[model samples]
Target chain A: MKNVKKVLAIALASVMAFATVACGNEGTPAVGTESGKTAAAGTWRIGGIGPTTGGAAVYGQAVQNGAQIAVDEINAAGGINGVMIEYTFEDDENIAEKGVNAYNSLKDWGMQMLLGTVTTTPCIAVSAEAAADNMFLLTPSGSSTDILEGKTNAFQVCFTDPNQGQGSAQYIGENNMASKVAVIYDSSNAYSQGIYEKFAQEAKNYSFEIVSAEAFTADSNTDFSVQLQKAKDAGAELLFLPIYCEQSALILTQANAMGYKPTIFSCDGMDGILTLDNFDVALAEGVILLTPFVADATDDATVSFVTKYQAAYGEIPNQFAADAYDGVYIIKAAIEAANATPDMSVSDLCDALKEAMVNITVDGLTGTGMTWEATGEVSKDPKAMVIKDGVYVGY
Target chain B: MKLRNKFKFDKRARQSLITYAMVIIAFVVVQILLATGSMTSLMKGLLVPLCVYAILAVSLNLTVGILGELSLGHAGFMCIGAFTGAFFSKCVQDVITIGWLRISIAIILGSAMAGLFGFLIGMPVLRLKGDYLAIVTLGFGEIIKTVVNVVYIGRDENGFHFSIKSNMDLNMTENGKTIVKGAQGITGTPKDATFTIGIILLLVTLFIVLNLINSRDGRAIMAIRDNRIAAESVGINITKYKLMAFSISAALAGSAGVLYAHNLNTLTASTNNFGYNMSINILVFVVLGGIGNIRGSIIGAVILTLLPELLRSFNLDNLRMLIYAIILIVVMLFNSAPSFIQFREKVTAVVKSKLPKKGGVN
Candidate 1:
């Protein structure tokens, strides 16, 4: 009896301590806002979320860096409507649950706008809650069409999977690169699978024959020999690879080992493949892909943004960074056009921002004439890029 | 003597009552906090996941702790339940409008399917012991994930069609909805999972597992675990008891899957959700919590689930997993190390002496 009572007392005390700590943390943000210690009276709080530690860390880190650069530039220019932008970043680890958790945490911190959720799954997961809470979410790289379904305030800066896939197919046919093409994809990945399905459907309309289509799981040790051999046997002249950087590197290595060289084409997922450590850059030579941003563009806006990003991060920015960099400017334009004030509630501000975003257009570093439609779809023409002399150059 | 015996409480009953009281107390406290808006939305969002993990931990504890088996495919069972339950709900969502009813049916179907798979897998796999069993279960998990990635199911005016190639091969009408789109998975699952429902399902899992542990069959199974030869000589069927415990554990994990599936808008057979990592995570919860200790499993699940989220808020995202690992190691050391046990006893003695004695001591 004594022992039981002692244990119960300890448990109760621990529970109380935890409750106190949680309450203390929750109250800190509100208290700080009230005290005006860090943020001014008219400061706009913006939060960014992305997978900064997982497999997609490169994309997430690029997005965070890009958004920070934009925020720094905007604040340096005397801010938006004379209200300084205070930015906070959260890492979601590419998990849907973690993404939602990050979203809620930022909401608790009194964030009014969200520039985030670099990957597809996290973006889709967070958008539902964003809709429910009436928060304005502008994802820089999430390109799933399913994410925009029934979501009013959620928007993406990247092209949808179908758009990129169809565009790639059209580009291939118009260039007369090959009449017979093959596809190698990771069936376990939603992004890869979605792109493959759309590309296969569009290839038929372009009079391109899909001689072979093969898939492999998402395991690290997956060898592409069997699939690559099958494609080679089928006389495929062009190989469509819709996978991420790491897998693309592995596939390139395996294909080189098999002594099979074909014109490699991919989507935006292959943007940073050439920069991965220990990757064979020679294998990536002449590989073509469709991307919304090109680091070697001659346009003034693109060149300046790339220069700034290289100066900040000591490396040229990928498409993810460019999209995120543009995402911040888009948000800034919408906020200015909506005449939103910091005093308005988050939901009201979100409504005004949504209306403004649909009607506004921003010429960003990724492309000119970038616009958001009423259905929360983004419109931007991507550039054809190819790896040349160990770097991506506009084709 | 008779009066004393009448007043004496059964030790097992007391422990069971304590576990139930602890769970209910924790649930009520969280509910009150959520109702009063004292908890942040991040914490609120963790409630359903917390329950789901608790269920997984407890069910895994049954296999790894009580049955003395080293199964590493708990998440595989969860995957089966998630995909099947989500598929059933999507098919009948238009017909069944009541959220609770639809979820209940889905849970039943999911658990049944998982149990069937558990039986089929256990028949051949359970014959192998120790490392072999662990390896086979791990393979089973990977196999389930791979198979689900290729499976496509759709419903049209003609009937339900299943294919391994693509949704177009299902030959569905224009009005037909694709239930499972291969790797894309079932999307737009009705978000009917609430904290209250999660809590209720968790309670059901606790009741079933705890009652099974206390039942006669439980004793028989534990006897087999303790000494299979002696148990066999005593007329105990080793295979029957092992299968029973394994199937029950799988079913409970499936129920957890039902809660998980309905909570999310999209259910994918991805590495993060229902993969090798998740299986190992549940095993960690059991081992770190003191194997076979039910109350410890609950505490372990809650703390570990909240630890990462708490760490994220502190701008320690890079070290989130490291900190979680360190905390687990520290807790496990405290639970098992002889020096810590002695220190704990001393502290308890000092605490007891400081407080006044109540009633007669044991």
Candidate 2:
């Protein structure tokens, strides 16, 4: 009993230490404001928001690296009016609450401008916080049209959700596609909903019948048998599962096992379909997905980007990574443009950047030139690519 | 009676004072921020969820720590309450034009809805013992999540679909129009969750819980927890008290859920009502803060909610889980009983040695 008490006491003390460390740096900067802080030595600060360590970290880290590269390139080109830019990355973990927290942290750090983070939920959370704080913000990959639907302060470097949806519907309709459609969507994710909603709406426009519209929770159940059964009963000839890549692959494998193979149409989640070693190409046979770019699809600037990205990361770049790379360059261009005009305020710079986005169309590495709407969505019509023998080749 | 009166200053009462003080301090800070417009909408956004989590942790602690029942399906009741409350709130919103009336109706309706579900679920499940209860409750939670996902009463598509992979598909078609918006998420919920409302509800919950704990029912429940057989021998209606506690707990949790749904202005059947992780996290907060201690649960809720934000400031960037892991290890290590007692005694002895003897007793 004495020994047990001793052990308990030691454990409690350690717990205090653990709690302190776990809550590490949130020690003082609890309340955050946007007023600029005088630097100790006048080092320029750039803000970054993304998931540094969740399931999406692989994509988020790459985006951060791309931003770093752009910053490095600019500094090398005689330092944006002779002031070296230093970046502070804020990890939102792709969660809404954490995203709000990160945005406040960046605002507290007095960031004039911020970039990266592809996910919609984080973007919404960050943009709301940033708008409240009066900061200039841009996202590389968040494609939710609802994000910038009414907001003016935030700008997205990626295409809007509407364009992707419309593009998918147009592709299928023009091609005289299958009449009966089945969709499996991630009920929790807005991104999945965006694509599924678009496809369903477009299908309706073309007089295509939706046989099965089943929604599944994220990674909830392994098998798609029940959903597939619903689809089969409805006599769905074309299957549209616009879900995340991980779950999409799982569904494909499950659907194959259930012996109900329908022609699968997915969205950008299928960008990395070729990279799935666990499931073979046979499962994804005749599957078409809409994405921003195919590595081998574009030439001009895209070729150079794909070459450089593959050289650096030692792998073929997906649409997410490429768009993220472009996001960094766009911000750099804005910062440079802002610096070019000597008396430019942050808002003035934001307007100028917004104008630049609207007027200019660059044949970007991600796909084509960005055609933006006033809503801040970069209008890159989703390109439908088919998986032919384990390769993403454009149709 | 004389001897009992000598040591009657209850530990629970002392703890309750500290909890009240902390709550007051938190409320003052919130009030200042709201008045200044610094916090603004965030106070409304976070207040309901925080209150809900606190109530959840505290109420669960009753079963997990005090009553020694490991029920994991608490979220199931929360879900039941949310749906029930949502139905009531929708009904009230559709008819009532007055704001205060709408709010009062919603709260009362939400709590009642939760109580009804709690009473129904608790009656049968309360009969089970130990691990069986935990497993059954856990399963019930999953079952509730599945029900919400599969069963849809109506489609409330406001003409937009939001997806993670692609963009928002604009469904201009009329037949496919939905009300819940299906997989996309049900949006445009009324924003009624304010910091003041949240605090008031929290206070009400605390008052009820504290009063219940001090009452005869609470003591009987505790008595059953201490020794079920002995409690039964003393003619305690074990089932009745357990059901009462469970129902009240469920009602509080449900009220929290209603507040949460309104505050966020959107509800995802997949995320809002689904998942075992939320239940586990709340349970962890309760245990970490010290089960059966209401103040401890509140502290735990606040700390757990704010921990990740705090960690982000350390330049650690993305190593949140690693940080959590390290902290867990350190706490477990330092919490070894013998070491702490030894350390406490050593500090006491050192202080004693430094002091001069009092009345030559040394």
Candidate 3:
């Protein structure tokens, strides 16, 4: 008994020491936020919150790396409004409570401006907390209109849910993509559910007849055979998936095994499919999606941003990255318009940015001449991209 | 009996006091930290959740330890409480403008709703023992989460509208506002859960549970746990005691849920927060704290909840979860393994003998 006790104690002690040393091993961050010290003057402290550790990590990581690239470029170009930007992204683990904790921690570190919360639920949770403080927030990929409802302090870098749905239906209708459509979406996620509601409403005006609409929750995300087989049996020519890449990758594989193949259409949520670990890139072939950015675009801004991102992270950046990259520049433009300094209080800066956000137009890698309304929704035309040779090409 | 009367503490009363004092001291220390400006805002935010988890652990220990029944659906009771309470607050937030009064009624309503479900589920569930009971409770937890996910409730000037099909099915006037959006859940709940209130609730849980355990009903319940046949032979109402313990445990868990729903800025149904994952986490707290040991469960919950956050503050950002898993394994082994328990008992005996005895010692 004594021997067992000693052995367990020794093992736990060693493991604790190892955990301390392992913090700096990951290339993510050497240290986390300081508790008491606020951001110093002359540096605009911007904090981001997202799920860097959970099921939706792909979106969070893309946004984290993408926002970093933008900050680096702006600092190299002599800073935003003559002040350097300091960016810190906290992992929310894709849970609402943790997202609020992340927001409060960022506030503790004297964050002046916010750019985050990659997913919808956490974004909604954090936006409510941020609204209470009247902090200026620009979510890069949180496309739920609920995040902006009754709160003028928050804005979306990506199009709102209705916009994506309306845009996709219009594209499919004008191009005569398909006559019969089947939709499979995550009903629990605000991002997926919001888009699905609008898409179902908008599909009424299109040429397609809705054959099947199946819903899945996050807990039941693993098996898509049920949802897929139902859609296949409906004889739908096109499957519209308004969900994330994490589940879409599995859905495509499951559908493939069931010998079901149909034209696939998705929203910006399916942007990082090729980069998902252990996913066969070939399975995602011919999957067309409506998004604001395509990495392979020949535009000089897209090429430069894509090249820099690949050189830095050794992988092609996705639409989430593009949105985050544009988010920072949009923040810079709004800051320039307001002539706000880092020395200002968070509430003052938020108030100034709120007015300036409506008046600024940004030409970014995501979109050229992007503008936002006082409703906190961005106005930008989403482009259609098809996966060919495992890369997104203009449809 | 004369010595016990003179000392003003039997073993049971002393044990209960220790649990109360443990909570009180911790609350005082936290208050001091807050007043001193030493505590971080993140830690302050977690204080209410700590109370919630501690309450959950203590209540679950009652069903698992005292009743000797394995219940994996305690979180299901919690979810019922959370949604019911949240629904009431949403419907009447306008009518009941007073925060404390509204929240008090919400807690009572939430507790009653959860207790009703516990009684209903325990009727059939308590008939099964061991693994069968465990499986059914697990199913109950999943069923609650899934049911809440599909349920949509909205209210307008006309009345209340509810639908299981879709939110669109609830065709209300343009002025109508949704209280619960099917999967997304209720948001903007009044964040009224404070640390002081949490501590008070924890005390109430301890008071009720400790008192229940020392009562004649608790003795009957434990007898039923020890030997069901023997307990039945002694004329103890087996089903009555069993249902009593189970329902009370479920109701305490419901109070925790009431605190939880009000603590968050948004209330949503998800696996991580309200499903089997959370039920298992509470079970871990109970088991690691030595099952029936009420004080130990609270200590375990507080430590496990704060461990990751404390590690995060120490700059072990990503490694905290990994280290937390390892610590849980080690603690569970130390707690439950026979050899480790034997070793701990031996060491404590030696230490006790080394100390000088007081007059109360025979």
Interface Cα root-mean-square deviation for all models: 3.0, 6.7, 6.6
Q: Candidate 3's residue-wise lDDT over A1-395, tens digit each?
A: 44554455446545643443342232112112331133334688899988888777878998999999999999999998777888888889999888887887676556788998898888988898889889999999988888998898999999999888888888888899899899998878888888887888888887788799998887788998888888999899999999988899999999999989999999988888888899999999999999888888898898999999999999999988988999999999999999987767789999999999999999988888889899899998898999999988989
True contacts kept of 2: 0.21
Best by DockQ: 1
Q: Kindly report which residue stretches of model 3 are placed more than 4 angstroms away from their true locations once superposed.
A: A1-40, A254-261, A277-283, B1-9, B336-362
**What digit string (tens of lDDT, one per residue) describes model 3 on residues B57-147?**
9999999999999999999899988888888888888888888777788888998999999999999989999999999999988998889
Tens digits of per-residue lDDT for model 2 on A1-395? 44454454456545743654343223223223222323322435567878777767766776776666566666777655665666777776776556666665665455667784467766765676555545667888777765675567678876666566667777777787888888887766777777766766677778567777887766564677788889988999888877777778888887787788788887776777666557676777778888777877656666766677777777777767777667766665655554534234446656666666566565566656666665676766567788887677777
lDDT of 2 at B203: 79
Q: What share of the true interface contacts does each candidate keep?
A: 0.48, 0.21, 0.37
Model 2: docking quality category: acceptable
Ranking by DockQ: 1, 3, 2
Best by TM-score: 1
Candidate 1, A295-347: lDDT as tens digits = 87788888888889999899888889999989999999999999998777778
Output the TM-score of candidate 3.
Answer: 0.90
Question: Once model 1 is optimally superposed onto the true structure by TM-score, how far is the C-alpha of residue B93 displaced, in angstroms?
Answer: 1.9
Shift of residue B284 alpha carbon in model 1, Å: 1.6
Q: What is each model's TM-score for chain A?
A: 0.93, 0.82, 0.88
Q: What C-alpha lDDT, on a 0 to 100 scale, does residue A122 get in candidate 1?
A: 78
Q: lDDT scores for all predictions?
A: 0.85, 0.66, 0.85
Query: Each model's TM-score, in the order given?
Result: 0.94, 0.82, 0.90
Q: For candidate 3, what is the DockQ?
A: 0.32
Which should have the higher lDDT, number 1 or number 2?
A: 1
The candidate with the higher DockQ, 1 or 2, is 1
